[model samples]
Target: MIARSQRERLLEAAVRVVAEKGYGAATVADLTREAGISRTTFYAMFDDKEACFLAAYDNVAEALMRRVAKAYEGEERWPDRARAGLAALLGALAEEPAIARLALVDVGAAGPAAQRRYRAALQRLTPLFEEGRDFAPGGRSLPANTSRMAIGAVAGLIADELAEGRAEYLPGLLSDLLFATLVPYIGPAAATREVGGNE
Candidate 1:
């Protein structure tokens, strides 16, 4: 097998170490050791532990976005695409709980840069949420910031599950999350049917 790049190894190691030790406690030495690379190699790719952690966070977030986007592809309806994307995301988190925690939890404490990156990721998702606007009641329209708030609320809930060591239970929240996201636009009666229709 071909050997992995030093940068990839370092990023993977950073995700594992940061998830286990938290960004504050994890060190460059720990990252290099976990990656099985020399300190020189780590420095060659990243300026410091924070930089490596930020890179890892970006990688994780990008990977998740790709999965969600792919799942949303070829779907005619917004609710169908939303369900598909949620399933893809929850499935990914289930398979990579450590990286999930690293991206969702540890990144916040890593530094202001990481926090900004997290906020950017959330902002980027607003359009995905906004796509459902046409499904809302004819006269009832959501506010401009409603998408961000819904995304933030769901992110907060996912963070709580990860914090409680119940990451595996995240998929179970899909219906409720989907309901919460679409309810404002679709209204209760339609939203209830949309959420429960899948069952």
Candidate 2:
């Protein structure tokens, strides 16, 4: 059986190759050569280029989630945790530009498998915001409908910012946008204070 480490190496190589050459132009042969593995080993690990792309997408998602989790640690308030998590996510995008492109942009090009993976990632992440609903001040809560809208808004904003080459400024911009949106529930005075304190 192939080692997990070897699989990771191949996935990493695939990410780099795909980011450079794009999905249509990237080949399993290119990935295997980049990973310094035999074609047989590549096939043993992944069924095809599409399968490999899915694995690479999973890898990027896991890495981004871990960064977010780390950033959320030690924050007792929900708003603070949300801001920190979003900031960490944006930071990851800045640090790993390929992952931002893969997770947000190129994902659509990867077909159904990638779409499922993206949805799953968003589902897993939703709980973090849900957990912080009480932190909106005065025991205010986020309605389920609004929460979904907020999540979609934030994701779309980040994706657009990354595509526009403003990824580095996304954390602050996202935080302000979310804070403003939540101000009605949390109270504009309190929300402004929180944003000012955080900034």
Candidate 3:
């Protein structure tokens, strides 16, 4: 196979370094050493570690988001769509624990700009959750921030697992996540029923 470019190597290293040592502790030297590139090359590719990390974070988040959107496609019901989308996310994260941590848990500790990116990444999922409002009978009665809150609930559940080094078990959370995603718009009885429905 052809060799990866320096920029790609640096971004990969950024994710690895952050996953291993976290953003505050990971240094430029650590990134260079991990990527097997010189400091000069690292600087040439990225202005700094944060820039490199943000790029990697965005890459991982976007890929995961795309997987979820694709999984949700072809499903007419909102709950099925949410389940498919969430299952896709959990499976992807389980396959790459480091990227999972980097995308959710580590990004929070990466400083203000990284935090902003994390928020933006989470916001991108709102449209997926917002569709529930139209499907639920009590959709009009739900609070205005229901979609944002539901997204937070799902993210919180996943992030909790990642922070505890239980990324591999994320797929098992499908029911709980589905409940959280649906509970805001639909009552518990219906959310639980939907979660327990046929795959």
Q: How many backbone clashes does candidate 1 have?
A: 1
Please count the clashing residue pairs in each candidate, in the order shown. Answer: 1, 0, 0
Model 1 misplaced stretches (Cα beyond 4 Å): 1-4, 138-141
Q: Alpha carbon lDDT of residue 124, candidate 2? A: 63
| C-alpha lDDT (0 to 100) for residue 52 of candidate 1 | 81
Residue 67 in model 2: shift from native, Å?
1.2
Candidate 3: worst-modelled 10 consecutive residues by lDDT: 1-10
Tens digit per residue, CA lDDT, model 1, 97-137: 88787777767787789999998876767767788777565
Candidate 2 lDDT, tens digit per residue, 1-199? 4588889899999889988788888888899999999999888877899999888878878888888888877577777777778778777787877667768877777788788898777666766666646655444445665555556767787778778877667655755655644564566787787777866
Q: Count steric clashes of candidate 2.
A: 0
The 0-to-1 C-alpha lDDT of every candidate, in the order given, reads 0.80, 0.75, 0.87
Write down the TM-score of every candidate.
Answer: 0.90, 0.86, 0.90
Q: How much is 146 displaced in model 1, in angstroms?
A: 2.1
List RMSD in Å for every model shown: 2.4, 2.6, 2.4
